[model samples]
Target: MSAEIAPQPLLQVNNIEVVYDHVILVLKGVSLQVNHGSIVALLGANGAGKSTTLKAISNLLRAERGDVTKGSITFEGRQIGKSDAPQLVRRGIIQVMEGRRCFEHLSVEEDLMTGAYTRRDGRAAIKQDLEMVFNYFPRLTTRKSTKTGYISGGEQQMVAIGRALMARPKLMLLDEPSMGLAPQLVEEIFQIIVRLNREENVSILLAEQNVNRALKVADFAYILENGRVVLDGDAETIRKNEDVREFYLGLTEIGKKSYRDVKHYRRRKRWLA
Candidate 1:
């Protein structure tokens, strides 16, 4: 029998550095990969360059006067360092940005239709995909005609995800899908994220802070501090790591710390050494 060849990852971000203007370094030597049919989580604090990394991949950094100063990002076999955002979107990479940025004036269905704007596929295919989104987010079915701003926060988050689904993405960059929602809604969103990966075969690169929730859905995880990847491993292993359990998960040998204490406690990360 012949030796089988291992396949390359669906997306690869290699030792990338990002900067705003000609100064202000953001990401430094940060590299990670998302394999086909897998979810990879980028776990970090607020200023840890998580969003900057996603914006770099989606080529959205330029809008904010940011640029990838070093290294490269590739999707499949293509080097996409200079590719425009629309080009990436057409190439089947979609980014659902944080804060549920829906078209508030537009109806829920209309907001979703915008995702297919780059598609050359016929209207029939588009309509079918719209229904597919609806199937995945049944809550949006009744709210289809409602303006996005009029819906509840949870419903708007659903619209944001549904809109991305309409793009028929090969890979989805989800930035904090659980941000600012109630605990119950956060659980629901992550459940749908898993279904999208397993059932629809969409690979995910998620930038998140909710380590506990993110670990439940991620296959692999990379922890970021400042502008660098400090540690990475399989999600199960990360969940049990003593450092992770203490700093991010609020678990200590003493006991679980309250959110107030955990947030205030200075993070003495050994990973930085």
Candidate 2:
């Protein structure tokens, strides 16, 4: 019988440490991997280094005066230490940032077109992808001519994701796609994200604080605390973990407990132990 080759991870972050402005040590030996055609969620609290991890992967740290002080980041087996954001984008890794950033003055369609700026594949191809984006986010079709800033928050979020879709990314770094939106809108955005993953075959590295919500859509998950990955497993296993239930998901053995009831309960630091 012939031997089968193992597939390399689509993205790899190996024991990386991040420092901001040469002083603030943020990510301490943090490491993760996103396999081909899988949705991997990076779960944590606000300061747990989720966004920093995304920025690290996308090479956006330099603009913020941050640096990867240790370890390595590789995309498809090539070390990306010196690769810039534009280069990464050209290579099909796109980051939809946390704040749903878009050009306020640009119409929704115009904002989306910018995502295709790096492509040399010609206008006809770009327009085809734009239509693909609209198909996934049908709400965008109705607001395509409106200035992005004038749209509802949910629509603006749709615009942000739609713009990233226009890039035709192979891997998407989604930072908190559910932030600052209604419950319904959050669900809607996540549904579109899953659709993108399944239909487009785009691998995703999702950074989110919404443990319950992120786990629902994630195929695999890593939980971070104070800049290190504390626990990791398939999404379903992580969901049923007792410590994760009590700490992150706000559930306990009996039932849901108020912060007042569980305030004094010591959260076990499995990483430290």
Expressed as tens digits, the lDDT of each residue in 82-181 for candidate 2 is 8999999999899999989878999999999999989999999999999998888888898989999999888988888888888889999999988899
lDDT of each structure?
0.90, 0.89
Question: Tens digit of lDDT per residue, candidate 1, span 1-273?
Answer: 001232888889999999999799999889998888898999998999999999999999999999999999999978999899999999999999999999999999999999998999999999999999999988889998999999998998899998988889999999999999999999999999999999999999999999999998899999988998988998999999987888888778877768676656545453432
* lDDT of candidate model 2 versus the reference: 0.89
Please provide TM-scores, in order, for all candidate models, with all chains considered together: 0.93, 0.94
TM-score of 2: 0.94
Kindly report which residue stretches of model 2 are placed more than 4 angstroms away from their true locations once superposed: 1-6, 254-273
Best by lDDT: 1
**Lowest lDDT 10-mer window, candidate 1?**
1-10
Clashing pairs in 2: none
Q: What shift in Å separates residue 131 of candidate 1 from its native position after superposition?
A: 0.4
